[model samples]
Target chain A: MSDDIGQKKGLTRRGFLKSAGGVAAVAGMAAGGVAVGARDGLAAAGSMPKKWDQGYDVVVIGTGFAGLAAAIEAKNAGASVVVIDKMPVHGGNSIINGGDFCAPGTRLQKAAGVQDSPDLMYKDMMKAGLYLNNPELARILADNAGGALEWCEDYVGAKFTRLNFHGGHSVKRANQTVNASGSELVNKMLAKAKGLGVEVKTRTKMERMIANKDGRVVGVEVKTGYRYPDEKTGKTAYIKAGKAVILTSGGFSNDITLRQIQDPRLTEKFGSTNQPGATGEALLAACMAGAMDVQMDWIQLGPWTSPDEKGFGHVPLFCERLVGYGPMIDPATGKRFFKETGNRKERADAIILIGHPVIIMGDSYAVPKQVFPRALEKGLENGAIKKFDSLEALAKNYNIPLEAFQKEISRWNSFVEKKKDDDFGCMIFPEARPTVTPPFYAARLWPKVHHTMGGLVIDKNAQVFGFNLKPLKGLYAAGEVTGGIHGAVRLGGVAMADCIVFGRIAGKNAAKETAWG
Target chain B: MTRKHGNIRFSPGWLFAAALAFGVLLVYIGTPYAAPKQVASAKAGDCAACHGQEKVFSPSHPDTKAMSYKDCLGCHAKGGPQMLQGKLPGSHLHQLRGVTCEKCHGKVAKPEAVEEKLCRTCHNAEKLVEKTAKVKPENPHTSPHYGTSLDCTLCHRQHAKSENYCNQCHKFNFVVP
Candidate 1:
């Protein structure tokens, strides 16, 4: 595609080189149109190196939950493994993530007396995904999620101390980490991987995947000492992956250009919940090396995020916790909008359709009972979540019409009293009470790009598939880098489960691949 | 006739390959690479020592060639109209306080980036957190996520413009120095 543009623009690679002179001419070629596409701008997969600067049996890209888990498993499976990340810090988004790991039939679930099964989890995922999910991959994720969580707790020594509920779930299946952050699990996994003799190298970035004449991935060109968001900070070197290379570099929620290619609505205007390093270059590099992508347009938006704060702020904790206990009010109309307890896509879409930020509120009773104390205090401190002494004060603060807002609150109160939501079909929690208490708490909700549900297609064994309907030899993938596990929309807390389960599988299978070297 | 340079053989194929290789090399080395400015002396008042010929301060500013840290506070003091605390590089403050390159990086031919421990020697993390505990919006020194465990280098760059690294995910609006 870029070649055609180059040809039309009279700036072909060879022509530019012939027209200009020395090393300075190269910069002119870059400025002209020698490189248009992302892959065209970089080295191709066919650029096989005669020598390597480094060698590993399994090369894992990224150091988040998935990459660390993959490195540990590959090392345990008797393969010399190396995990690399471009960031200065080890953990990516996983470190700052709200520690919610969803799995069916876990110890936490058993202790919490929440009856859940793999079948129920699978059904919920399919229903929320709109059944676009590849059944086999989704089934593998569902069946193995519990085992993965157990491995994290038992083997990695990460604690799952509480069971929580998420939207689009049959039961309270999400197991919260002890520290309420994914760092609890990720840090443990990093320590375990390091203890197992797996080298975790930060500031190392993958430049491009190298494929031999047989069209099999053999190694990767990398740059050491790489800085995040800076393409030129690292030193170039080739790392030969004798066994295989596993791509777990995560999704493109923060890549405006890449995300817009899939979902046009996901422009720069949409804020992202992911770290800035969650770009799609690595995934696209895999595609250039013959990997097939599935459902690239299925980007998920978190409706609970507040526009007032940055990234995935404290408002989500308040908004998500209060969903079943309160009502989502459209400030303009001062009425209940969509079902407060709907799946992320549904809720985000409903808010986007309104073309304005909406409000979710709970009284003093639900605020203290449902919301985490720290989250509430921090949210109030940031002015994202506000407290009102009365419903009148709440309406006045949000510029909501007093009469309609009062009527809506009373109508919502009646529904809460009867334990049924006739207005928006919102699932009123069993323990929820009327919002009659003084000091109401509320937060404004705007959607933020959360997860990219489409990526490289992978099989049950986590082997990346090519356009030819065959496994891309010497290449494996797991976590958000692979698609079809969540189909159209990934449920909350399922990301950690997917990463761990598929990461372990990818590592084991990649280690078992015949060493090309 | 192909242009040959040093050990490289320059043919059409080789030139194309070199162009592509140089393209790849530019990405690896990072474009617009600026070598660290090396000051000849440890004196605080040598404006042209590290800055070279680059005009940093406004022309209307008073001459500061021999000014000390206390002398800098004459106009650019704390709570002033043009405070240099968060605006200037951390290295300038370090130099003004007599902590030269050797203080953190030691006497080396090529001084590299210092460790977090170097900063912790003078600025205790816990103490700093306590000091900024009452800063409005949210505390910049500590956070609920990482607390004070985040490396000071993430925000307080010595040579470059200090950034609020927390703004990557949150709108903390911290004026980092």
Candidate 2:
């Protein structure tokens, strides 16, 4: 009976002899013809079979901005590309992202009368990243961001309809998409990728990269028809990558265990804004295949999220717009807290130290003029954002001492009148007004795991570097999967730029690789 | 000792036992049926057609052997003593409404999963959005973010308990079915 079961599973004689615990390992060996110890004995790619279950010139593993961008570029470069995603949905976090593409100098910036340059943008990144950023990679992103944004606008046909400001940027450089969601760009990219005959197969997950005896990633072992978060759902198969394999499987923000290993403070107590599939399995698979990782402890937390909401809820849309124009108060103290315009890490850390949710509030003037109407309405509808008729009422709603809160509001109003923040040094926008308006809006602020600043180490050309300190041939990575561009911290809206820029580079370079087969 | 050793050698008796054991193992692991048989002439109360004589409902409920959707609605109104809309899977509702399994799945050896387009054939997404515009918190069919293109299966699973897909990212307590 056991022997029949072994035959049904396509297990070899040796595989059948192994214990049930060794089934998975024996299965890989059966297909690759490399025993467990023999694999480590080889200096490079192990001795595997010549035949493959499937073949593609370039296999891209992800369907987010980075993966789609890579697929489109590789296909355009004349490579027969196939993009695979483990999720049932095509886009990962990119689809749900807030659609802020930061570029140094773009038409949107120009139309908004904002003076910005790539040099200045690079400076802001370096400052926020604590100068730990790889200068070469950061330089590449800064220089090419505008060109990439233009490509997304002109070539991909994704419209950037508005210029917005992110906390760490020097100017209003974030080009907001038409729908204010990354879907506007991701859907367009998906359409373009499909139009170019780039086959995108969802529910197909890469189990591991297959390297030859020379340590070059030649292909990948994948499970087709895989359902995400269900380890037992897919049937294993080997796919031959004729040229290269691109890993753009994004970050580990949603990976609590992995993130806690890197930054112990990031426990499951903190929620993430990423998709459920935004775990570390794919990135760790690359590491198991000899890929190097760097600065993995540097995870970013978004301070704009609300405890009252889920995932990256509409509170972010409300809070981001109100920052620099309103005050974030520690409800416990009923007074102002950290600089509202502080970078993501500082603000999140400060809120954690406070040990309770904070309140970010804006008046009718700021709420109407600054916040997106849809977001404000939705936030209110969800009961995360509340509108109060008076300053006392707002304070009472959040259980803030009315006397202290009123005094703080008066102080904040004085700062607005003087165009200076006397206390926490929040960036005060020129259009700011006092909080004396009849209707006041507020949302309780808390931190949610937002982005990972570390991943696979790659060079400026997007070729992944191996643990052996050599470029892993036939391997490339881009977007959130590859790190060192953001270094210690990734500023807001820079992810879109990073993904688009490096995705194109990885795609073009991957296609240029000599086909091993 | 020699005889005992000889008894352990390959023999037709032992081989027959091994083959029989293997057959039993195959039956244990393999599915008994290829797919659920969908008879076009089957009635709503024909439990034996698909489920055999297994008791699927509580004993306290009226005998459903010959009951249709209208008969069930007599006791289980939209929001009455027993509402089945949110209580049962969408396929059960279809079955009760006289929508045979072959209607949506068609006559096939094995039925495949249906897409949102299949649901839209009967229920228009745009009209759903307009109809539910006044739903207290907000409309579920359309949104400022995804608009009306969200797959119906995300919230209207036929074979399983329906879920509010928006709850993954928002605090919308929508009673989806």
Tell me how each candidate scores on DockQ against the true complex: 0.25, 0.28
lDDT of 2 by residue, A112-182 (tens): 78888999999999988999999999999999999999999999999889888777777889999998889
- Each candidate's number of clashing pairs is 3, 5
- Candidate 2 chain A has its poorest 10 consecutive residues by lDDT at A15-24
- For candidate 2, lDDT tens digit of each residue in B1-177? 124745766477556556444544544444554444556567877766767656667779677779888888887888565777778778878988877778888888787876568888989988998988986677888865567766687688887679877676666666665
Q: Which of the CAPRI classes, incorrect, acceptable, medium or high, describes model 2?
A: acceptable
lDDT per residue for candidate 1 within A2-99, as digits (tens), equals 34333345435564443313233443353233123324422236467778999999999999999998999899999999999888777788887889
- DockQ of candidate 1 relative to the true structure: 0.25
lDDT against the true structure, per candidate, is: 0.85, 0.84
Off by over 4 Å in 2: A1-51, A324-326, A362-370, A387-420, A428-440, B1-42, B47-55, B58-60, B75-82, B104-139, B142-152
lDDT of 1 by residue, B130-161 (tens): 98888767789876456666778888899888
Candidate 1 RMSD to the real structure: 7.4
